[model samples]
Target: MPRNAAQTEIYDALGVGFGPSNLALAIALSEQPERLRTRYLERTRQFGWHRDMLIDDATMQVSFLKDLVTPRNPVSRHSFVAYLHQARRFHSFVNQKTLFPTRIEFHKYLEWAASDFEHLVRYGQTVTEIGAWQDQGAVTAWAVTATGPDGELSTTLTRNLVVATGLTPSLPAGVRTSRRIWHSSSFLSNLRDWQPPDRPRIAVIGAGQSAAEITAHLYKQHEAAEIYSVYSRYGYTQSDDSPYANQVFDPQAVDDFYYADQQTKQSLYRYHANTNYSAVDQDLIEELYRRQYSDTVSGRERLRVVNLAKISQVREIGDKVRIELSSPHLDGPLDVDLAIFATGYRPMDTDGILAPVLSHCDLGEDGRPLIGRDYRIATRPHVTAAIYLQGGTEASHGISSSLLSNTATRAGEIADSLTRTGRAATTLPVSVPQE
Candidate 1:
C-alpha cells in the first residue's frame, strides 16, 4: 500500500469500484465546473476489464462507437477513438471497417483511459463496510471502511457514495469449485496453472457465449484432449442482435423501462431476455457446428456436444471428477478430468454492504432497493447524503445497467444529478492527495 496522509479529509464523492462504470463516473465528474473531491477504491492491483476471459478472437458485443464516453460526450478524451488516435491506430482501425473490436483491444483501451485517473483511484483496497453518519437524528454522510493490501484498515468519509463493485460470478446450487472444478470467469488463468494428464477430458457447462468460446478454445489449445459441452438447451442459440431488438439497449429505452409499471418491467425482461442471456454469436455458433460436423465426417470426434442434458451431481473421484448426466438419452455417470461452469453472473446486491444503513433507505415490495431514475437510492427525507448506484439496477434501469452499453451515459446522468442537487461541492479543508 502507498503511504497515506492524515486520515481527516472528507471527499464529496467516493466510488467503490474502479471498473469501466465508475471510471466513466470519474471522467464525468471531471467535466463538472466545481471540482468534486472524488476518490475511487479498487480491489485489483491495477486496472483490468475481464482480463481472464479476454480471448484473442472474441470481439465486443457492442459497437465501437458506444465506447466509454461517446454515448455521453463524444468529444471526451477518454473515448475509444481518442485512445486509438493516441496510439496512432485511428486510421488503421478505420481501415479495418469493423463495428466491433477484439476483446483484448477493448481491455487495452480501458487501461489507457484509467491511467488518466490514477490520482483519484487507489488500487489494492477492498471495501469491507459502509456506515452512515448521523447528525441531529438525520444521516448526513457516510464512512467507508476498506482493507488495504497489507491488511491495514482505513476509513474515508464522503458525502456521496457510488457503489459499482460489479457483478459476482455464480455457480450452481450445491456445487462448489475445487482443483478439478472451475468457473469460466477464471478459465484462462486456471488452465495455465493446471497440469493435465495425457488425454484430458473436460466438460464445459452452460449454453451461453462464454461456454461456447471456452469449448472452442479448449478444443484448439489441447489437441489431445476431449471436450464435452453440456447444456440443457437443444442447441446453442444465436443472440438477438437484430436492429429492432437492439433498440432495447438504447438510451431512450432506459427511460421507458424506468418509468414503466412493475408488470411492464417483468414483461420487458421476459420478452427481450435473448438479447443478453444464454445466447452466442452467429459466427461462433456456426464455427462450432462446422467443427462438430467435420469431426463426424472424418470419424475423429474430439468435440462432443451433450445437449438436452443436465448435470445432476459432481463428485470428486481419485484423480478425476464424476459428473452424473441426467437426460432422456443418457444413463450412467460420466467421468471427466475437469468441469467448467460458464454459468452467467448476478448483479452485486447492496444488502450485504449496506446492511448497517439499510434502515434509512426505502425498499420496494420485492425487498429491493428503491432506486430513482437518476440512479440514487430513495432514502428517508432526513438522510441528506446521496447514495448512488452505478450498477445493479437492471430491474428499474434496464438490461444495460450492468453492461458497458450505457456506462458513459449513466455516469453523466449521475454527475448531472449530483451537480444539480448541489452535492458536488465539498467543504473538506484538505487538498486531494497527489499520485
Candidate 2:
C-alpha cells in the first residue's frame, strides 16, 4: 500500500557512512529513487576510502571484473566502464593493457559513484546515535542523531536504517604512534612531511602486501636507506587467485555462504580468508623475493626480512622511533630506528548508541546481530522496521561484507527489499515547510 500524504512525520531510510559499501547503496537507490526513500550521512566533507594510504604504486587487490556494478548488471549505466567512458579515459585505459586498475583509478571510480547521487548524500555530518520509537511491541520509527555543518545538532526520524559505519584501523595493543612511529594506513599522508638524513634504517612490521609495498617504496624513494621487514610468519603467504579458487568470490557464492550452516560458514571463511589478508599477491611476492635475492648477491643487504620475529615495544624519542623485536627462536633482542605496523582494521561497533535498544533486536551467542540474508538485523517481536547492515555483515552474510566483490549486488538487493516490503511517506506535512 502507498503511504498516506497526510502523515506529518518525515520518513527516511538513512545510510550511516558514505564509503564504497554505502555509496553502492546510494547508487542503487538513485537508479530507482521513486521506490526507496533514502539519505546517506557521511562524517567527512566528501567521499574517500583510505586516502592516506593511496600509495602511488599500489593497485587494487581485485580485478576490474569485480567493479561496483559489473558482476550484477554489466549493462548498468553505473558500471566502472561507464565511469571511464564518462571521464573520457576509455582509450587511455585500453592502452594500459592491465586487467587491474591502480589504486588511484579505483578511488576515482568511487568518487564518480558518489557524485552520481549527490542529492542523497549529506556530507560533513556524523551519525552519533540511533534510537527506536516503541508503539506497542513494534519499532515504529528510528531516531537518528546527526551533527551537521557549522557545529549544529539535528535529529531526523526514519522508518529504517542502514548502518555502514566502516572499519577502524588497529595497531598492536601496546604500540603507541607518534611523530616517528606510524601505521601503514597513514604512510603516504605522513611520509612527505617526515624528513631524515640519507642511509637511515627503517623497520616495517608485517608480512602482508602493504608491508612489502611500503618496503619497496621506501627503498626506491631513499636510495641509500636500509629496510628491515619483520613478520611473525616465516614467509609471506601467497594469495590463491587461481581460476578455481577465485570462483569462491563469484556472485553465486553469496547463496552458498548464506545457505550454509554455522559450521560450514566458518569453514568457508577460514578457507578463503587468505584471499584478502594473511596473503600477498603472487607477482608481488615474487618481485619482493627477487629484490631480496639481488640484494644478497650484491652484498649490499639493503633489504632484510626478519621472519618469525615480532616487535615487542616501540618508544619514540624526538624524530626517531626505537623498536624492540623479540622471538623465542632468536637468541637476542634486535632494535630498529622506525616501526611501521601494517596491521588491518576492525569493524565499527554500534554498541554505544545501540545499547539502549539491544534488547529489542535478536543477537547471536557472540553478542553480534543475527543479520538476515538481506543484511537486515534480526529483531525480536518488536522493531518492525528494517535495520540494514553493510560492513559488519560478514558474521552472518559471509566474507562479502567488507569485500568489494558483492557491493553493487548487495545494494540492489537491499533496495529491492525495502521498496517491495515497506513504504515510507515522503510528502511533507501541511504545516511544515518543504526543503
Pick by lDDT: which candidate is best?
A: 1
Candidate 1: 10-residue stretch with minimal lDDT: 424-433
Q: Model 2 segments beyond 4 Å from truth?
A: 1-9, 149-151, 317-319, 328-332, 424-435
The C-alpha TM-scores of every prediction are 0.95, 0.90
Q: On residues 92-168, what C-alpha lDDT tens digit does candidate 1 reach at each position?
A: 99999999999999999999989999999999999989998666676667888899999998888778899999999
- Go through the candidates in order and give the C-alpha RMSD of each one to the true structure: 3.3, 4.1
CA-lDDT, candidates in order? 0.88, 0.77
The TM-score of candidate 2 is 0.90
Candidate 1 regions exceeding 4 Å error are 1-7, 422-435
